[model samples]
Target: MVFEEGRIKQWLINYINPGMAFNDIKSVVTHYTALHPTKETYIFNDGTPMELVNLQGTIPVTYKSVVYNIPIIIWLMDTHPQHAPLCYVKPTPTMNIKVSKYVDQNGKIYLPYLHEWAQDKSELLGLVQVMIVTFSEQPPVFAKVKPKEALYHPSINNSFPNSVFMQQPPYPTHSPYPQPSYQGMMPQAAQSGYPPGGYPLYPTPYPAYPPQPSSMINTGTGTIKEEHIKESLLTAIEEKLMRRMKEEFQQNQAELDTLKRTQDELKQGSLKLQVVLERLEKEKSDLDKNITVLKDKEQELDKAIERLSNQESMDVDDAVITTAPLYKQLLNAFAEEAALEDAIYYMGEALRSGVIDLEVFLRQVRTLSRKQFMLRALMQKCRQKAGLTVV
Candidate 1:
């Protein structure tokens, strides 16, 4: 008896989705039917009992009780000839007609066969007419009774009832039914028509009393009328309405206050966001300036490298013409230099291996010495530009 509204809503959602196939519908119906048994008759708005009758169909369905013939319509929607054929007991001949196709202004197409046959008035018109005719022909029966009057009264004497009085009740010859006892004189007055042990054949009719005046007069005073109470009731109702209006106004004011608070919060949030965005823009400008400075420094370093390369090329030409003894001395000096120690050692090994001539080896040594001098000068210039003393 306690239906879960949420569960039914979920079922409806599943049913209406276009993606749900026939099998899904069948399963959903089966589950619903299991929860709601068929033995119980579901009454429709028209007071008709619905019995579930499963018609033979491609889709396996068990007929549950139908209420207001709704199950028949449901079965038709499930399995029609165009989609899936459904067979039912006592199938009407008029139901064989194919349903009409209806399309909405939205261009949504609904095949007549897709809808229930009962839903189509044109299709079920004759059937409904036939049903109405049959029902009218055999109307339900109701009981009727007429009031009887007492014509002649009969008397019964218990004292002489054995032979003389037993032939019949003494002459006025009323029915032999016993009379009911009266409240004040029960044993003597039995004219009320109910017997001692038997129930009354007819209920006693109540005597009608004359209506009283609407206004009542107080002792030696003016009359008090219902109008006073009516006026008071109306006044109370007006006061209640005024109170309700005041309460509604208060509620409206509270709602407006809440809305104003929300608006204030939103405005504050927007202002904060604007402030953050401005700060971000400033940071972005600063980063762009830093990037430009780094690019300039890179350009300066490239020019310095080009100058050192040209100077080294000139130094190598001069060293090639110099004496070999002077070259050897320069080599020993280059080996002792901390910065060029690794270069000197590798060059010495190459010369010893006969990979290069003495002239080429002397030139390379001179080029390396000039490059080291240029690098040291560049480092000192960089330190001076940065306002740092070179050690």
Candidate 2:
């Protein structure tokens, strides 16, 4: 919206005094308008209207007599109800005032009086008119405030007072106590009994009237007065306390929700760890059973070798070997079994012949045999599963 004098003044007042009433300023004018044939007129205020000098033709109005020359003239146009008034200012020769010209270090014309003239009220008014013309040449700054229906519905135009168009209502003033209510549409004032718009005729119900003393006047009498306590401040404090409590409750609830989520995550992690531990224990048990079966096979092979050592010849009869197929089967089961036994026998003979240390040879033979036997058994299982018989 285009800035009006009233709006500008209000902004200035707000800048100067935050809470003071701006309407008390008598010199400040609003919606000021002037025309050419009438010269200059202060239509709204009771002050004397200023005289206007007509420039024979268009000329520029300068601060002093002149550094530059131009023309000034004013144009009049009818004002529309929904639109701001239209005016124009064209430059004229007579309006220009020439001053002593001076150039600084830079080649620029300097006119002291011309600068002062630009600030003059008459010159400012002319500038405002020029701005209006310039703006009209371009697009409108704002859409019309009134709707199209207002134009067709004549009653809508008169529904609100003219003051509503010029001035905005004061923002709802906050009060410590609840605003007093009346039976009908009109708002009731407080104990002051003054209605809106500065009217004081309305009667309002008083919530805390002073109590009368019972004692009457006798030959001599005394009067006593009681003080009434105001509860407005207390009410305001209570409202603030309630608001703070509500905010604290919401913060606490958010913390509780976050804690609950963290707890649920920890529970899920614990359950996953439990499942992993159970699977690891089962795998450890299966490995132990395989180790026990290997130990039993090794013990049976040791007994058979001891019996062969006691015989007069190293070879056993085929009939005697055939009577126990289990022994023969076990011997032929793993491909590396004969090599493992031969290594063990050679280590034992070397210790007996003093070629190696007895304790060292026995330890090496036991370790080598255990590892080779386990590996050979694994290889035999793989060969059998692939349908290849041992040679």
Candidate 3:
């Protein structure tokens, strides 16, 4: 059987997260199905029903040099890779599940690979490989013994028209009394110890009931004469009781194992929850501290804004007073530098208009330039002292 790509895509689309890409999922599904075609079905997970792609097939496992096809089912969740897929042994009716550390009595599989799943690393094929290797060491399932049907004598068999005594040849015997033979059956292959029909003969539950003459049968004297009949009946009853007790013991053992697993899982969940709670508490404490620091910073900002708003607009000279001595000195130097620059420019204009002689203009420009250099140097020193970068 082959899985249709379109159908697989459709199933993913319907169940996967809207923003999650399904390329990995599709690839894994297609690749696995190439070997074992899987069936897609809907199942409830933790009380929430979801449509998922699952494979129900036998995986080839080798045990003691013999290869066995171990039936299994693998479920891929919608949020696969981010989470581990569920796996279980799906035994046939004639097969009984074998419980081990990797596999539970209920047939659920648990593996280190699954527990350590990483979204970037884990995939369906890898999980299946792990299962194959684990099961090879100890097969997850074994065939059950087929029950034998009750045996009866040919005299009793002759009463039923559907009895095999009519068609099948009789088993060889070394009894003192001659054994009855069929008239038209194939010769018994005594050496082979099987009839020509190739069916193995089963030993009777008890020796043949003594041949009943019509007079003894009619008089009921021949009934229950063989003590072996009573012994066989008691033995069959005891065997049945033992079989039933064994089944009940197995069932109870499985339940106990299931409960133990559940307890371990619950303990793990509780530990995780406790860790998360502690982490949340730490985050909350940090947030509270941050809120207090923010409130203090906010108050400082509000006070600074209030102070600035209350001040009236003022000239640069008026605003520069009554501050640190270094700041005051720096502002005074800047003002003088500006005045000297303006004086030099106006002197040049006066000379160009012939309002002043070149000699006077040159002298004035030289003096202003010298004083401006001094002011600039002083400003740089004051800025450095104030821990500000010199511009």
lDDT of each: 0.37, 0.37, 0.59
**Error in Å for residue 352 of model 3:** 28
Candidate 3: residue pairs that collide? none
Over 4 Å off, model 2: 1-231, 312-391
How many clashes (backbone N, Cα, C below 3 Å) per candidate? Answer: 9, 28, 0
Clashes of 1: 9
Best by lDDT: 3
- Spell out the clash pairs found in candidate 1: 50-66, 50-67, 51-65, 51-66, 52-64, 52-65, 52-66, 54-63, 180-194
lDDT score, residue 388, model 1?
Answer: 60
TM-score on alpha carbons, each prediction: 0.26, 0.25, 0.37
Q: Which candidate, 2 or 3, would have the higher lDDT against the true structure?
A: 3
Better of 1 and 2 by TM-score: 1
Q: Write model 1 residue lDDT over 195-259, tens digit each, in one string.
A: 66312222222122111111122223333346754564576466556655655676688789999
Candidate No. with top TM-score:
3
